[model samples]
Target: MSVGDETLRNVNLVTMTDPLLGQVVEQYRVESLIGSGAMGMVYRGVHQVIGKAVAIKVLKLDYADDPEMVQRLVREARTVNAIRHPAIVDIFGFGTLPRSEQPYIVMDLLEGDPLDSYLKDHAPMKPRDVIPMLDELLSALSAAHAVGVIHRDLKPGNVFVESKPDGQKGIKVIDFGLAKQADRAGGSVKPTNPGTLLGTPAFMAPEQVLGTKVTPSTDLYAVGGIAYQMLTNHLPHEAPSAIEVLSQKMQHDPIRPRQWQPSLDEDLDGWVMNLLSREPEKRMKDADEARRALRRIGDGKTTGAQPVSGARPAVRTATGVVPRRDWGEARTLITEESSGVHDKPADVSTDRHVSPWAATNTEHPAQVEVEEATMPPQPAPRQKFQSARIEAPTVAANPDEVLAEVKKKESQRSLAPVALPVDAPGEVPVTVPPSRAGLYLALGAAVLALLAGLAWLLSQK
Candidate 1:
């Protein structure tokens, strides 16, 4: 009998029997069952004449009659072809079984473990390793987004870690079964029906969990989850049940990466948390932007360290300090400096110092607005004579008490003689002249008066 006839003959076989095994479909012969999932089974196949090996993913018999399921499988093949990224698995061909009418996809047979399995064996991957893997993943994602395809179900299991011949690590993003083409892309695939939750719970974005609109940022959120797992060996959200995990994802932001792995680089922690923002708009704008951000982090260029030149500077308070804006929602604040000087604003709360480089939504006042500096400003020339730096007191104090302390410090500073630097070599130090000392005392008094009046006005309010 012919190979086609043999495949047709096995259509009525019992469920326990492996019908596809050892059967020829198209130009390839099935050798063994590679793996199985809810919707399909993958088999290792070899080309009949050339002896070329490939993976054949066949739809399970249970879903053979479902047109929607069949179309979804076909769509996965089309989506992979549309995005010809090296980091994405390549689809070779798509066909159907002779009598069973089951759809199958032939694609490159990758030789590596899925990210989840690799993580199981060697997790808590170093930042150095995770960064490159994440870069490649994001590069693939950028390509998909550019083509208006969003991988609605991105997870570690779908990310394959391949071992390159040169002893370098590589990755391939697989399984576009749940991917959706954006409306503007002119794709014929119908939009997913509302109220259909389609992603892995632990990695689903808030909007995705709500079954609302899904965008490129939705995939970025899952990227954050995968990155979190790779770095800390833990999912961003963990609960007793999947439902609870979804609830937590919608209601709260994941703990910052540094909280789990204290030794993690601060730049990496910031990038990961930014990706995990509960609101889609708050996350990285697109996959390309995300990839660039990852590159910056890997290059030791910390995000939010410098301010974007054109961005609106933070609102300045009467005290010449920028007050913390209430980030009521879970979002990262990207602030910029309007003035040429790089001023380090101190938190009003006395206990802790808030780094301008990183800020998250927190209940405490220490949480400050941070800006991602896209374009670093030119460095200013060093000044010859700098004023003595005044540190904030450790204990919390009321506005009135704080003003009094500042006034006291100002008086002490004015009374102390200021040393002048000698311009020529081997020259002796010089103290501020009598006229300069008098002017300094008068200026100090004026500043103290202004501060006292401002304090009184604030109290009245």
Candidate 2:
């Protein structure tokens, strides 16, 4: 189909079923429509060569005629491929349909619901319960930031909490369709109109809504928004319309997570609010530091006690604020009050601690913890350093020096008479004459005879 025809067809595609379902696109056989949105429709597909399940996302026909839209579609795959993190969805291939103008991308077939859906059943998760998810989310953003890709849209719907074939749950950040190039300058493609909203308004940062240059911190802001949702069971900001939401995001301060979940730690709420800062400069420097902060909060030992009826933890003036590198300094103030709400048992007991790598391999978790939290947080264990071997360069020496060195060795060997060298393997042993065992015995007999004669002489006297 021509670009105009494709665009016309997709203009009315919002309520219609995808036409490509049950058809083969490249190596994938589309089975069913997994979901649909303004961008495109995702279908569960089967790869013919590998016989593995995959998720096929086809670009909307309305965007087929737009050059910037096409580039952004391809850029999403390229950005995801560049990030190359386990927490991000794995892209298999990118292509356009054989005869249709619709472009498509193939990625890992996730086997569970998006985090938003997961939250419908398990909202307001305990800090420890959601720490792994937060770790994975921040890790994905960190990897994207390292490669200069910022995920402009980071709501819970884009994050998949999948249940693997094994009985383990994994976190996968999907849909980089709204991702922006962090360092793109003249070579970048502007996919949307100026002052136009690009991401989900609820999770967008103020700079994003105001059409400013986005950095890694923009993604960090989204992470904070999602963290707020995960902890409080609601978005940091919500409204009936996109304009209102955007306006509030730009104008208003976010409600503290503790406002909804008073049992939460103040340090945790401060960190979340720091991420939701109206100014980009006020947020964490990058996702890596944000991940570290969340890990610190997660690593805190808690009593896992649910709040008693009508009881609330004492709230104090939040001090030391965010942007401080030392999480401990910011956290020390709330240590006593927040101790009871931790998701772990109050007594020393074994707790399931899954490592970052456990998502890929469910059979073997990287770590499990069995310790008491009676004391303050201890310093992280020191890492052992491995020494590397260094060899000096070899150089040729003069023949005279070699001869003198050999002679010195020979003189030293001659001076030490009893220093016999062991023979090399397969070499004949050096023969020596008799040891002086017989001579020593004869001398001893002569000494005894002389002693006997002396004794007789003494008796005669």
Candidate 3:
């Protein structure tokens, strides 16, 4: 399925019941919530049997009954489980949660921040450090795609980096909930809803934005965007809606990294720029190619161009590179420059991120007012939900079903009282019948007989 970036708005995501775990499961003690998704809640759980800490992802009733989605999740999880790479998260097992009948996937508990936050915190790492991480990611992607899996949505947030057993940081890719096989594009069982976009727009490929057929190259484009962020701390273009952003991907050419850092080593800059090529063929085909390009640059052999120096004045490329900065970012940059701090641009050491200046799009009139007249309005996803940076299920479900489910969940949220677990199977089914009038009559007769016997005894006395 071609992934479009879906920025989720104000929708309540409900999970399925935990039947496998029942009131009690083997050794895994369900801890407090960690995070949530449209399908279910992720809990920090302890495995009692093994005496190890584990994480259990429980399916809520809302999504549990969705057999198709569940199966898809299962299939993807199974697929992911088969690939044991240092850079891919490990899927331990999948099974039913305790009492409720919903399914859950048990995975290795990890400690690390999302790549998005990681990138944001790390400002400009030299190519040496960045290339290794990129290499791991590319290898993971290559492994995934080789088995007919396409990580329809790939972004910094979906990636996880942890200190490996080998004393180096290992990157693990996560959230294959929205992943699709190479064969499923444009078929009846589409991943997303009709006309709804999937994937994160800011980093999505031009074809992905257009909802066109995608391959490994689609992911390559997103990696390219990551490289863009890595080198210059910004995205290529900014648009209002997913559709428009996609349009930019199709029609616009991104600003070459060379223009931003004239002093950048040529191979590194070219590697970054190659990922941004509008033509999939022209761009680095996959993560490994991109990684290798980075590696070559870090070695200083100059596989492409030599490094330049000084500001060459940001030239407006005829290739659709917009000089305008994203308003959200422009405001911040303008403030930073105007405040007299005039900080130097981040040097490459930590993958210093500078978000591209995106031009905001105005909402269409109908879209703006659709929920206004609705019976009762709830929150819709703003820009964030639209940014499909991770492998979220971009495949749209039936629009009517999705909307109905969303509304049903909303109503349930309003009507439900505080919940307490039933705990055991017998709790819900066990009940005592009410007393009957015949029982009262029986009690009265017994008392009368006792009184009569006492009277007989008194007479005899």
Candidate 4:
């Protein structure tokens, strides 16, 4: 029989007789089909020796000839096993079913709902409720990152939440199937071919959409996207198709979470923004930094302060100065700057680090408004100084003409009664330019008159 026919035959046999139902692989006895996907079938099973329930995920016979797919299944099991975190799902065993020659992996049978399902059934979760999950998520990611494993696929569907035997909630991050080692790129077995796009579009970082190398920060970008959904009942970027979603993210930033849901408050909004930074380096340098920022929110230390529009919260130093943390790993000091949600700059300060996606497009209209809104008002004295500087060259060309211009300006300024000093009721207050050539000219005339009077008095003597 052809490979296609053989695969169909196995599917029919498994469905009809449930042949694996009483069969044993290692110590686990397959009971029933739990689920099936393009790559594999999952079964609910019981460990014969321990009598504990475990999930069996079996690679389909249809793809037996596809070595890369087989390797990816094995890699998923091995990669997840390497990172030991409670928030991550556990792998119990791995083997092949003798009857069909299908490979299988045993994992913790998650009894709880996927976060995606839970959110659909329940009301939108409060930020407070989401914070703990994010904390655990970060912990899982932190462990994974420390060992150089980047969870390329992180979405609500991949996260499972269950109530433990102790009645407390527990989290399990599942499916490291798309995960790639930090050091290697463009060579791993991919759902699409190597270097092809991966990850759900709504949660994808700009780099992922652009098919660039992903790092630990790439995973956190998805965390931010998930947090946005948890808090707002929506994805940060959403469209009917993946291509449209990618186009939108490339065109505009996701609307600020606070703007979508006003209750997120200032600090929490800023914290999420930090995670969603388009530039990887601009994001929290590592998972640990992200955790501490969240901890600050939980502890209520970062209250009342909104981060500056499109800027990360300034890190307060020992001297109480809040230095800008946007430049990534390098500290630039901006003191006493006010914090408020503002439109992100089309190009953040220097051109060297501007997002490539943004470089091609004109600045968004909203960002223009932000640039205008955040612009500092020029001080009056500074304005006057600038005026004088502009006219300085003209003054240098003709001293008398420049002096006359200065006198005229002073005269115009003095005409405003409010600017004149109060004098005796009947007397008009004369305004003179301080250190003006006109004042010196009047003083010289007075001195000449006095000298003429002195000479006349001496002649009479």
Among these predictions, the greatest lDDT belongs to 1
Which residue pairs clash in candidate 4?
309-342
Full-model lDDT for every candidate = 0.64, 0.60, 0.55, 0.60
TM-score of 2: 0.59
Winner of 2 and 3 under lDDT: 2
The candidate maximizing TM-score is 1
Note the clash tally of each candidate.
3, 0, 62, 1
**lDDT tens digits, residue span 132-162, model 1:** 9999999998888888899877887788888
Candidate 3 displacement at residue 190 in angstroms:
8.5
Question: Worst lDDT window (10 residues) for model 3?
Answer: 355-364
TM-score of each: 0.64, 0.59, 0.61, 0.63
33-126 in candidate 3: lDDT tens per residue?
Answer: 5665566666667876776866677676787878776886696577687566667767777787545677877777776666665666673555
lDDT of 2 by residue, 326-383 (tens): 3343245345323442221111111222222111111112111222222222212112
Error of 1 at 431 (Å): 67
Clashing pairs in 2: none
Error of 3 at 168 (Å): 3.6
Show where candidate 1 strays beyond 4 Å: 1-17, 185-191, 303-357, 360-461
Flag regions of model 2 displaced more than 4 Å. 1-22, 184-193, 301-461
